[model samples]
Target chain A: MIATKRRLPLPLAALSTGFVLLWVFVAAFPFIWTVWGSFKVEQDFFSRDSWWFAIEGTRTIAQTGSAFTGDGYYGAWVLRDFFSSVVNTVIVTVSVVVVSLTFGTLGGYALARSGYRYTFWLLMLALVFRAMPHITLVSGYLLPFFEMNIWGYMPTAIIVLVAINQPFTLWMLHSFFLSIPKDLDESAMVDGCSRFQAFRLVVIPVMWPGVITTGLFSFLLAYNDFAVTAMLLSQPNQTMVPKIASFLGTIQQEGNVMFAVAAVVSATAPLFVLVLFFQRQIVSGLTAGAVKG
Target chain B: MPHRAFFAFIMPSLVAMLLFIALPIISVAVQSFYVQHERVVTEVETCTPFAGCTKETRVDAEATEKLRNEEPLGRFNGFGTYLDRNHLAVSEIGAILSDNAGFKDAAARIYNLPFYRALAFTLTYTFVVTPFAMLLGFCIALGVDAIPPFYKGPVIFFSLLPMIVTPLVGALIVYWMASSQGILGATLQTLLNDPTLSLKSSAAMTWITLLVYGIWHNAPFSFVVFYAGLQTVPHDTLESAMIDGANRWERIRFVVIPHLMPLATFVGLVQLMDNFRVFEPIVGFSAEANATSLSWSIFNDLRGQVDQLFGSAAATSMLTIVGVIILLSPVLVRTWRDFNRR
Candidate 1:
């Protein structure tokens, strides 16, 4: 039993459905194609004879004696030492997330609770900071980092990433803190708790949802970063994104483009899982700022 | 909160930002006024038994290192780097104009300069992609809203993948697919009836490819925002509009658009900021020969083959910061007014 009043006309319904399906195909097809292609040899994946060869893996069978092979993965992970880069990425992203959240929460809470005019200016400054091209900042850091003899360490990169993550983190957490009823903390203060104690005891418990959302963004920033990691990191301390980039340079020269392909798929897999699990939080975090504005 | 407590609470974050963010701008500003010290060359007369004595000039590496150690900021060059041929090229543009070249010729000459070329592409990409992405996103939001609720979740999850993926990786995926041997590229070549046709083969095709990539990467963000905004459209207002003899289109035009206007501004602002700094796509696409952005120019300078051009990179960085401020002025002014009103 369809509600006739609310239903779209048949033609319009068909058009809209077709359009939505087209968009989905456009969005998801490339990743799916690449993932499937990662299993095949380069000739099969980028088949010039016919596109069906990509799907059918004709050359893949001839080259490896099987339609699917782990040669690319083996080359990237073992011979190229992508595992060390993965380890570095873990250390950097984890440290950045933890430090950014710790600092962001305190700063964001203070900004939300404060009544002074300077708070507004602080936020405005952050807006300007947020808009500055990140490479510009990297340019600034290059000389000083070299002079200080700390140019290529994981800790230096982590601290720099945490700093870069602050403006967005502060703005997001500030808005989220605003949404929390002020009375929850005010009431605690009336019972003789200091401001810090009140925040620690009362606000902390209820802050996880917002903190978790902001933390997801921080993790993404640190993980997806290319400029800082590529420029600031030593060769041995490179992260996954930059490692994939470096793979393009060296592996492509070795005539093993499939290694880069496999690494790309490997890098994307975690993000796929991330979106699958935290889709709700990522969406909310994105809309949180927009909806409030 | 008390002043002391507020300061104490914000100290760590504020210090991090000031030290890392604020200080870098100052450092860039200072570095822009100085060029790297030229190699200290010394003239020496050498006497040999087999040949007549000849004067030779050689770089005094030890002395140069000493000078560098004493003053690592390099030799001060005032605004020389900013006005150099690689950058603003004030005198070169003046020469072109004075020579009475045709407007198109003059424009092309100016665009040939590295800074202007990057700036032109950056502004064009930002302006073109932002609106198109927003419109496409709004349409997609409407389409999703019209669909059955059960399918919306999966649609959103897929829609988000383009944006959730790293910009570099996402661009690489498109780059690989559009390579001459790949499926889409091969299909296009056949359809166009030209085996020579490749997206990366020409400047125009490369620009179009990057623009399409930009739109695809950005539309999902605006889509998610607009979809969320669409959910909050008032049911009562829509019902009243319908009862007042307004058709579906009119009802949407009159009520829904007004409600979504603020969210549109939010999306536009964020997109403008992000798009202005487009760098990774150029790297991923390996389209630096065809296209570059302001960020890419800075990266290029910093990663020079022989020695890093710190002064040149810093000058470009300072200019980029100024550009960012100019882009953000309107929003900042509005926010300032709102704050004062409050």
Candidate 2:
């Protein structure tokens, strides 16, 4: 009886694992291919050199012939508009992180600790912007921006990027801050910290980790966006996504160019995130915020 | 934070959002009533240079200039944008509104046909991606939580891989992979022994790739969220569940899942919203692809067409946004109570 009982959950766990593995397999190849292909040059790209080989000699020579091992990353990064991609990515990502955090934390804080009756309207307002298809936003804005030169000076891409990144942080960090009891703030105020001081000195320090996690997501999401970059930028000013898309048409085009840069770009934030999340408390905040939502 | 300064701290985001997001919505709304300039520029540089290498040239300017000379730029003709682009006399929009027979037949048609279809597409898309993403996340949470502590960090980080990246990149990656000529295209084709795989059909390609892609991108995020939820499970509830001889699934389903109901609901609802407006991937898939949803089609009318019709596209978008708000109401109502309580 016990054996039969234990077996029931086994299949569920296994099924879940199978699902995870299937997704992982699907997710891994393009990423790995991106890394490998980035090393090969144009001649190799056209030769269908993207096709993998191991232990074979002649084809590998032809494939590896034009591949410059030493400077590929540097070429993609500092030389071949990669530096600009990094700059654009950084500018957009950093601004998004700061702005989204402010909105999310404050919005979430209001949602969490307020007696304000209109908070529902505010929350739903967030959902409206969050839920709307970004393409619709892109489509609607293009004509107006073209007609009205006021927004012309500012890069339209950065503006949309912020809008897109805002909802998630609001959702994630709202729960994070809300979970902290109102009494905690009340007590901080009682201890003579002004409400602002209580938030800054008391509550903020406690929720700093949650803030970091949300900020990390905002920065990363802004950096890697394709459609925004593709639509917003001119070719010379392309961020990583448009750059990747240009490299993306076919195996006939340079597929490896995307793969290599993606590998590098995707790897950047996760490294810092992993380091920051080493402590269990912060790591769990992400799950808590997401799960509770 | 004091209420006043706290409000002040939040003002920057609010202002940025208002200018970029809110005003754009208003601008689009206003512009929707006016016709878009139909200038066919002969020699604008292609932003994506790789897609073009031919000498620059032009033709359509003749028609636009003639039209402009006859009438001032941005002149509006009533309700034409909604129907003309589809090349359908009474598109599904007209068919739906025709039932009303109360409003002008044209107004009825525009709202009923295109508006409903756009709403359906957005709702279906969001509903499809959200819960499953949550499930995938919760499973990851279970796995990482079960593991020895050191392994959690690496696994969690990797799982979050998609979450950390932009949604646009996620779509691009999937588009590249699912294409017949992409990196894994050959592999999948080889596995099937057919020159064509599922990518041959546009909608099928979207569903398969988008679903899998959504999971791949979201599982780690969901895991992190669910894991955090798991941490907050009061010990008393767990002890009680164990004492009752409740299995882990029973504990999770009864005790744990209930606690996450608010969360699961929110994530599910949000994902529903995200998916409903699922324009980028379809657009990314290409013009040749037949899987264009109502949103993508409406957008094409405004921006992606031989003729740009700004008014009707904006109207349709407004209608679509309204539908999403309706869908969000139940969750917003509940969250409101929490926001108000002492």
The number of the candidate with the highest lDDT is 1
- Candidate 1 lDDT for residue A230: 95
Model 1, span B81-152: residue lDDT tens: 999999999999899888855899989988999999999999999999999999999989988888887998
- Give a tens-digit lDDT track for model 2, residues B1-342: 445754665565566667667876786666656675566667645456577655565767687777765643377755565455332335554455556666666563553444444444455556666777888777766655554455555555456556655555556655655666555665677788876565756555555665666666666656666677767777787778788999867987899889877667656665666566666566555522434455776656654535566666676666666766787777777767776683
Q: Kindly give the stretch of ten consecutive residues in candidate 1 chain B with the minimal lDDT sum.
A: B234-243
| Per-residue accuracy of model 1 over A103-165 as CA lDDT, tens digit each | 999999999999898998899888888898889999999999999999999999999999999
Positional deviation of residue A24's Cα in model 1 after best superposition, in angstroms: 0.5
Residue A98 in candidate 1, Cα distance off native in Å = 0.8
Q: How far is candidate 1 from the true structure (C-alpha RMSD, Å)?
A: 1.6
